[model samples]
Target: MKLAIMQPYFFPYIGYFQLIHAVDRFIVYDNIKYTKKGWINRNRMLRDGKDVIFTLPLKAAPDSLDICERSLSADFDRNKLLNQLHGAYRRAPFFSDAFPVLEQAIRFPNDNLFSFVFNSITGICDYLDIKTEFTISSEMAIDHNLKGQAKVLALCEKASADVYVNAIGGIELYPRDAFAARDIELKFVKSKPVEYVQFGAEFVPWLSIADVIMFNSANEIQENMLGEYELV
Candidate 1:
């Protein structure tokens, strides 16, 4: 089986989904330590023809707490986020079709950070018609203490994966020789440049998947998803 693993992210960019779609099984690495200023709880969105940021508030926890152990702040108002998205993308061509999916995802009842983000990720995948099987790292039997490539190899072993696919950014982090020695092929996926009309302005790239869904139909988006990457 082909496998890919990544930290859970809230409304991540299209490349994130491309990585998930490229693999047979995608693992959400929720047992890892939470990092400040990371993409785990925040992502970029397009507003007024420019990039803007949005984030999920989390309850205070030790810096070392695993992502699965963290909780959303009780003070987070789901309606406020929905309002923000509506205000920004209400005029988007496909808002009516896309907003309900975003609403259901953002309003997920679980306050745990990982659970909320995982639901959002899976929710979007469903809308996009991606059927890759998902696994949670915390539920896997592999030793979780191993860092970097060691942990990745262990997880691949546990999954019986002969091919390990990762986002292109991981090229420098994983040694090709090590994976080759284990009879596992390592490959990276680089998303081809994708552009679409957005309010008749110069295209903004790398916005959240929400923006893409708002401006494009499900079929168009799915075609873009399947055609927008090359394995390197």
Candidate 2:
């Protein structure tokens, strides 16, 4: 079986989905230390031909905690933020068809960011009709170390994955010889730019998937155009 592991992100970009789509089982690594400026809580959107970013405010987050254990800000104003998203993309040509779904997704009742993120991802999976099984890396019983390549290899052994798939960002973190020692094939996914016409302007590459979902229906977005990655 194929497997990929990554941190849980809030309404992340297309590269996130591409990684999930390319693997049979995808693991969300919630046990690692959470970085303050990572995609864990924010993503970019388009507004008036410019980029606008939306983020989930956190409350009393510790510098040592991983994203999985981080909490949302107590002062979070869900309705107000929802309105900002609507105001930003409501003018896009396909907004009429896509806003309701995104609005519903952002307004989901849960306050915990992790639960909120997982639900949002599941909702997107439903919208696209993707059937890949999602799992948590912390829940597995792996035998390798949690630092660097040992962590990945350990997770792979726990998942019983023959081919371990990961994002291109790990080009330096992973050791090919280590995976080969474990008899597991390693494949990296290089997600290409997904372009769409927004408001009849010049096409830009790599807008967040949330932006796409805000401008197009799930059915329209479900059509995977550039497709998956192939390693050399």
Candidate 3:
């Protein structure tokens, strides 16, 4: 089996999904420490012809807390967030078809941070017709203290993966020889440049998957998912 693992992200860019789709199993690394500056609770979206950041408010926790232990702030207004997304993309070509998926994900009654983000990832995968199996790191039996490449290797071993795929950014992080010693092939996926019409503006790249969905049909998006990456 081919496997890939990544921290859960809220409506991440297309490259994130490309990694998931490129693998036979995708693992959501939820047991790791939560980073405030990370894309865990926030992501970029296109607004006014430019990229804008949006975030979900979380209840206060120690800096060392795992993502699975974090919770959404009780005062966070989900509807208001949905309204912001609506105002930003309501006029896009496929907004009507995409907004409901966004709404269903954001309104998913769970307040636990990891659960919410996991749901959103799976929800979007379903919309895009991605059928890759998913595994949660916290629920797995691997040693939780392993870090970096060791942790990744453990997960791959646990999943019986002969080929491990990661996003291109991980090229510097994972040593090629280490995976080779273990009889597992390591490869990185780089997304091919993707461009589509954005109403009344020059194309903005690397916005959230939600932005791509708003402007493109499911078939078009799926084609992008299938053809948008090259493994190296």
Candidate 2 clashing pairs?
34-66
Cα error, residue 102 of model 1, in Å, equals: 0.4
Error of 1 at 118 (Å): 0.2
Candidate 1 lDDT tens digits, 1-232:
8999999999999999999989999999999999999999999888888999999999988998999999999999999999999999999999999999999999999999999999999999999999999999988998888998999999999999999999999999998889988889999999999888999999999899999999999999887665589888
RMSD to native for every prediction? 0.8, 2.0, 0.8
lDDT of 1 at 3: 96
Tell me each candidate's TM-score.
Answer: 0.98, 0.91, 0.98
Worst 10 residues of 2 by lDDT: 223-232
* Residue pairs with backbone atoms closer than 3 Å in model 1 (clashes): none
All models: lDDT? 0.93, 0.76, 0.93
Query: C-alpha displacement of 228 in model 1, angstroms?
Result: 1.3
Task: For model 1, give the 10-residue run with minimal summed lDDT.
Answer: 223-232
Total backbone clashes of model 1? 0
Candidate 2, 48-165: lDDT as tens digits? 7888778889988669876667778888888887788778876776677666656677888877667778777777776777788999777888742468678888888888899998
Query: Model 3, residue 62: what's the lDDT?
Result: 95
TM-score, structure 1 vs. true: 0.98
